[model samples]
Target: MAGKRGGTAAKERLSRDVIVASALALADAEGLDALTIRRLATDHGVTPMALYWHFKDKDLLLDGVVERVLEGVEIPSYPAGSQPEWHVRLLDCFAALLNALNEHREVADLVHRRFLGSTAGLDIAEFAFAALQEGGFGRTERAEIGVQALHNLVVLVTMEPGERALRDSEEEVARRIREKKVVLQSLAPERYPNIIDCAESLVDKPADEGRYRGLGLDILIEGIRARAARQLAEPAEKAS
Candidate 1:
């Protein structure tokens, strides 16, 4: 009987976590689009039906991969009355998330697409919300800012340059930036004054790009701090 049903027997050595790990490796090497069940089954020396025993559907399989990747992310403990401000703590969390996602470029898209449903995603949301609440933001404001924070994370990982983009030599990067600057500066200043005025910055490698996670998070935290202060002071203006 065991020999008759060879398909299941072939997958006897595979576990759910093993399958998810294999899928994650495949995605890391060749993007998420290449992570199909049939491909994974072949990789694992099993049949598609064997994978079904572990993950009922494709979505479930991807969910497992997401969870596995997220498990590597480190969420720091921000105790009450901590020395660092809440916004700082939030930045730390965001930095950790960016670094974790940076390691797996293929999963960055998946994280952005389905983050709200993942356990690590909710953990990050809860942490940020607590920080916002502590910062004196109202419930509605917290929700709005939370959405923005999540969006920023998605943009940071997906849009920012990855290992592949940075694989070029330093000379190549500088040459590319110089060409971009000249092109931007060559545009008719009469028609586009702003572009001409900021041409140097527009294509400045160090100033305009690179380390997007830090740059973007700095801007976001500053904006949130300013908004939180204004929101806190609104009641005082009304009373006075």
Candidate 2:
């Protein structure tokens, strides 16, 4: 019995939690793509076979990492604080997610790969459902539109390429706008009257981060409300 007990202890020397935790740390330090079972085994000073006991392959290991990353995401109760009164709450939630993603950029790359139907995602889905209902959307159709809006924002921000690489930096933002303004101004007046007319608006001065975020939030939300109102006014058959 003592020998059997010792054998069991040796068998359980490492755990899935330990492997996942180590993998998360490695991904945080290096990028997610850099995380390999062999590298993990080397990090833990264990043989590759030991890791296989925990994760069958890299994809499984990545699933574990995604779980770990989301475990840290705090989805607040719908009425937790001075939010939920309006669209700001939703924008704040998205901004918070972006901030979190920026802090742990390795997870940012993996954000699109997350299960959209997971428990965490369900909270977002449910949150939008409730918000739309409160905003006068009925229990039935509002939930669907709410989901569409949420997904639009998520996919838009997530799929937008090159936050780190190009077309998105302090200097680059200014440079691109300047270049665009120059190109628009050089166009023939009659050939591109619209671009020439709106050149100043197109290259408007950049707002600070807070104001910029607020403006974007305001535009999207107000635009959604306008669309909803327009749909409500149309004939039932014509609305679609």
Candidate 3:
């Protein structure tokens, strides 16, 4: 059988991971729409039928995008005895995941839509459990909860809202802000005092639209830190 070729008969030399990597590269270079089994077959030097043996269809291929996005990254497990720094590790995990998401410019939209279902995401959750263990959490679920909170942070930082609106580049945001100045000035100062006061700041406060994302990340991490402290104190309250 065709399936048997890469399995028992061929000694399983080729790998699913390699196939996924090739697809990811295609999405990176030519945009996600350009990717097809035939294109991947040409890029990978594999027969079309061979590609099917791995992904079957473009839908499965997209799921492969999530797999490749996470690839080899593993969450740090519970440390024995001494406590592992919780905030640093959690931030590192988000940084790693966000960095990977930023690499595939084209397929990022697809990944944003559905990546939490993958095993790699689950491993990240497990790593969170390890952090909770350091914070005096006894059950595995507390760690999972910590990871989930951090995951929300990463998603907010990385995922652009709505079809990106094309004019999404930092420069584009500035252009829009400048263009909105007339509208801002039209408002009565007495009627909308706060808008009048912050109007100049609104038309590109820190400039460089990308900096907005960096600022948002700081806010998100701060929120996560506050939440972690609350979670830690909760257990103490229960015990008392």
lDDT values, one for every candidate: 0.78, 0.64, 0.64
Q: List the residue pairs that clash in candidate 3.
A: 129-143
Q: Residue-pair clashes per candidate, as listed?
A: 0, 0, 1
Better of 2 and 3 by lDDT: 3
How well does candidate 1 score on lDDT at residue 119? 84
Question: Model 1: residues >4 Å from true position, as ranges?
Answer: 4-9, 78-83, 161-185, 193-210
- The candidate scoring highest on lDDT is 1
Assess the local accuracy of residue 19 in candidate 2 as a C-alpha lDDT between 0 and 100.
Answer: 86
Q: In model 2, which residue pairs have backbone atoms overlapping below 3 Å? A: none
Per-residue lDDT of 162 in model 1 = 21
Candidate 1 to truth, TM: 0.80
TM-score of each: 0.80, 0.59, 0.61
**C-alpha lDDT (0 to 100) for residue 203 of candidate 2:** 68
Point out where model 2 deviates above 4 Å. Answer: 1-14, 78-83, 86-88, 136-219, 235-240
Ranking by lDDT: 1, 3, 2
Q: Sort by TM-score, best first: what order?
A: 1, 3, 2
Error of 1 at 94 (Å): 1.4
